[model samples]
Target: MLRFAPSPTGDMHTGNLRAAVFNYILAKQRNEKFLLRIEDTDTARNIEGKDKDIMFLLNLFGITWDNLVYQSHNFPRHRQLAEYLIQKGDAFYCYCTKEFLDQKRELAKANHQAFRYDDDWAELEKDKNPHPVVRLRAPKEQMGFHDAIKGDITFAPSEIDSFIILKEDGIPTYNFACAVDDMLYDIDFIVRGEDHVSNTPKQILIHQCLNYDKTMQFAHLPIILNEEGKKMSKRDNASSVQWLLDCGFLPQAIVNYLVLMGNKTPCEVFTLKECMEWFDITKIAKAPARFDIDKLKFLNREHFKRLNEQDLAVLLGYKDSAIGALAKLYLQEASTLNEIREKVDLIFAKKGLLLAQYKESAKTENAEILEFESQVKTLQDTLLTMLNQDCSKTEFDTFKSNAMQNSGLKGKAFFKPLRFLLTGLAHGPELSDLFPILRLYLKDIVRN
Candidate 1:
């Protein structure tokens, strides 16, 4: 089983969603259980009602999880585990004040020494005060494990800190609480970012103390960084998921970009369905990746272009109410609501400069612009001639050759003016391509 444990902080940002997506895809690939656990133990930092937003966004992005769990609800279980560890001598207590710890840290820094709470005073502190902040004991031997992505990670056991497992408030610290919850939930595999590498051995010790039947596997995915190659956070402009959504980025495109980041894969694009087919934890890149918003934008544009018109309208927030006003303006002319919608949709889908601008510009007296529209009208008339005559390949070829000669123009000179007249752009889909859509307009003198 895999669990996506997010602390309810602010909104679920790009980094948050990326981690959740990876876990979701992994569980889906394996056909195993994927659970959502709200790690809201940090009472001060946890934002009220943020979990609903997180879950809602997850659903919007097509990421689903199994049982919804809350760590705050499991406080009693965590307390029981802390008590068990203390009784078994795996954890001990020391009543070290904040001032004392600060002084020790300063002295250690000055002396070029690793700062740690003096365990020699453990007994003395316990004797002076019955209630002490419990600390995990690290054995003086090298402890290590192989990471699924970043392989062969080993830490010196002597360098490990026997830090507070239970704080002065008697609340279990993050590391201790995480281990207890993982054990209770039967989470045998932990997939998280590589930043947690230093905390792994301590967690392993806790797992050992619990005497679980099966050993847990650790897979630390690489970090997602900013373009400057630093860790991305809410401070960064592109860090928020809302920014991407606002920029017209499809959710799948964002997920696809994140999935490939710090992971080796042959495919360029990955859909939610496709992700389940090709997910391989072993292929994840050990090297950290810089998050490129441009890549995300390109993927999103492609996704947007591929979406059907109905889906695109919903995604773009084009409600019928909004289009109703336009329908009334073109009521008599428009055959149905959909017909007017189709034109409005096609117009806005390309570029959203005013429709009257293009329509009026098409009838402009300027020679350059007039000549262009005239040439386009001529081409349309020629094509109509061919369609009506049932012209063979040779006849059409001769006509194209003669037309090309008389036009005395090629490339943009031919296409640019035509595009400018029809779509009010100096560039667009090819002239040959536009002929199909413009056939009716070409015949109708009113459109001209």
Candidate 2:
């Protein structure tokens, strides 16, 4: 059995949601029990309604946990274990404050010393008046293990931090709580993000102290990065999973994309069932993958193209509305939504229609496409004259050569007004195409 433990601290970020999806897939693959455990140990950071949102999001992806548990309910178990470790000399109390630790760490960093928890004060007895935090008795020997994915990782005792297992506030720390909960849940496999690699030695030490099974297999998946090769943070637009949903991404497409983060497979696309059948622990890549928004967009667009209009509506959560109306307006009657949506997107660029399409065959036409046709040509002639006056022939030619070359403009000084003249939208299809379309419409209008 496996359990997904997510802290109710913030909105579901990309990394966190990916971990959930991975766990769900793995559990389903092996026909094992999967559970959801809310590790809300840090009471100060817990956000309201986030836990519910997590459940809602998981349900959206068709992942339902076998059991649901909260760490707050298991505080006594953690404390009992911590006390037992203290009695066995596997843990001790520390009276050091945050200020003392920060100064020591800074000095150690300056001196090139291992700026980790030294446990120099590990031998200190429990402070009677003011309660002391319990520290894990880190072994003074090399601690290492072979990761299912990363493989053959070694960490010397010097690298290990004698971290706190229990805080002075009498609440058990993450290391102690996780260790106790894992045992209680009888978790067979521990698959999580790579950030926890450094914390593994301590977790193993806790397991050893409890005399629990220490042979559990482990896989630490890679970190997600931004386009700049830096870690993708919450501040990044693409970092939140909800942002992708609001932008019209299908949930299945997202799950499919995330599974390939540290995963290796010959085939490009795989369904959940296919992923389960082909998922190999040994095949996961050791290096982290940068989250490519373009690749994600491409994957999403492919899925969008594949869906029938009805299914697409359901995926987009527009199931109750007039799907056939939309299909007729944007899919059937028209060659593509990419065309009308291109026009509508200007009202939103790039973002397509939100409302359902409806039939309007009986509607009377006020102005013909011709009326807008000559207006478009007149606008272009005015634009050309303005461009010649504003810029040198070389610059004008550079801008005219390709619409993409317009990235040279810092602002919308070039494209903004032109879009207004064309479609009353800020941006749309290529300027070159628009000019020609307008010319054709104008010729028809002049003939009429």
Leading candidate by TM-score: 1
Which is the leading candidate under lDDT?
A: 1
How well is each residue in 98-189 modelled by candidate 2, as lDDT tens digits?
A: 76678888999999987777677543333533667888877788888788889889888778767889998878888788878888888878
TM per candidate:
0.74, 0.73
Question: What is the C-alpha local distance difference test score of candidate 1?
Answer: 0.69
Off by over 4 Å in 2: 116-129, 314-448
> CA lDDT, every prediction?
0.69, 0.68
